[model samples]
Target: MACVYSMRSSLFWMMLVSLTGLAITGCATSVSTTTDKPRLAQQSVLSTLWMDRAGEYRALCHQAFNMAKLQVDRRLSYHRTLEKPLAVIVDIDETVLSNVPYFSQLIDKGEVFPRGWKVWMQMSTAQAIPGALEFLKYARFRGVEVFYISNRSINEGLTATINNLVKMDFPFADQRHLLLKSKSGNKQPRRDRVEQTHEVILLIGDNLNDFSLIFSDKPVVQRNNAVDMMSSEFGKRFIILPNPIYGDWEGALYDYQWGTSSAQKLKVRQQLYNQ
Candidate 1:
């Protein structure tokens, strides 16, 4: 009778454990089934197109570099000062460094600017832009000084940026050559510092602020006017790289209100679109 009672108790406990396991499994399965599916499947169409035309994109980069070289030569020739030492100011992200992978990651995660940008910069896994390495090498061999002027905040990812650039074997990877933003978004002070010592013959970047910080926070019409005023300088003293991902142009359209909520921003964008 004692043995029978013990067997019955064990059976009861085993049945209770089995039932509990089954209940937990059912709940998990139901929760998973109720989860929402991803809206857009696969990579973004724009990113796919960019990847497909990468070869052409690279060729264009080479062409742009060749043009820049020619312009540099002309400027030096015009000045007739071979000993003056030519200098080129380049923007880091999206200009000389390719952050397509980072952008793709953001798209895959269904994320956008500010949050996505902070993550991308923190990752600091940006590769050199196509043909940029070759151009920098050529420029170095030709005795031209290279400087990188980026708007990335100095407080964030500063060390990571240095390490990533060094890892990529970028020319002028020295700390002195890198100029990051201080507390202010204004870059003119930094540009002025570079201009004080160097001639700054060529300005290469994917953004307008990279050329002249004056137009950094200007309105759309004013920015357009500023560009028109300096039209001759562009493609001559300035070589712009392509960056369709994000730019100040978008900021201008949104009135540069980065503090505004996404819903409010979207409403403003919708109104502009309707106009």
Candidate 2:
């Protein structure tokens, strides 16, 4: 397991460095009116987050899974029952498969999402996160059913996503267990489907939205309060992976309004800590 994970880690860097170089060149300029500095700044930060060998990016992923394993052990010793089948629900994209490469590819071309998104998904070359495969396999070994509940569109990226998971040797990569995004983008319905027969012990993902709909584009203060509200459940039943490069958390900064300029985003962050 150590040897294979190390190899995957190496492959991840190789792709990141290659794609970072490509993005630096591709996003040298954009069709949008946003200045070069903002695009250039985003590329720099994203590359550093994705490419750094010794960084918080790697450390946080490791921490999340370490805690998840502990959480699972505690759950079994203290809470689980034989009444229903046990399951661990996980989001697909950055939670299990590191889509930083796809994000890099998109930024490299200086293109936006909905344009290159499907292309990247079809390529389906995302590598598994460092501890995700082993931890999830551990869950299954403990008699837990692993159900993937991703917000990825149902008919669009489902097949490629499953293929990606299978290629990474993740267990339970099948249709019945793979629930995709419905038109609502709210996952509770699909989660409801799983709860009918399985007791979902852990909900794992990089984004809060992956665990519940309450996180959908709320105000920044409200979102923080919500996290505080469920603080107890975080490490126990909600395992959140780290994803600094992109997520709804960042979207909340700009009021969830699409097409907000990069300068505007910077301005908001600048004010986040002002007295």
Each prediction's Cα lDDT score? 0.75, 0.79
Which ranges in model 2 have alpha carbons more than 4 Å from their true place? 1-52, 78-81, 259-275
Structural similarity to truth (TM-score) of each candidate: 0.76, 0.78
- lDDT (Cα, 0-100) at 198 in candidate 1: 79
Best by TM-score: 2
lDDT of 1 by residue, 1-275 (tens): 99999999999999999999999976544332211212221324475357436687777677778888887677766664644567899988877778777656655765445546776777768888777887887778777889888878878857778877888887888889888887876777888888888788888887899888667889999999999988988788888877655678878987898765444455566678899
Highest lDDT: give the candidate number.
Answer: 2
Q: After superposition, how far is residue 97 of candidate 1 from its true place, in Å?
A: 0.7
Error at 258, model 2, angstroms: 2.4
Off by over 4 Å in 1: 1-56, 78-84, 116-119
List, residue by residue over 1-275, the lDDT tens digit for candidate 2.
99999999999999999999889965553334545334634554554456435476777888888888887787787654657877889988778888766666556655445556787787878898878999999998988889999878889888888888899899999888899986877788988899999888889998998887788789889999999998998988898987767778878877887686555555566678583
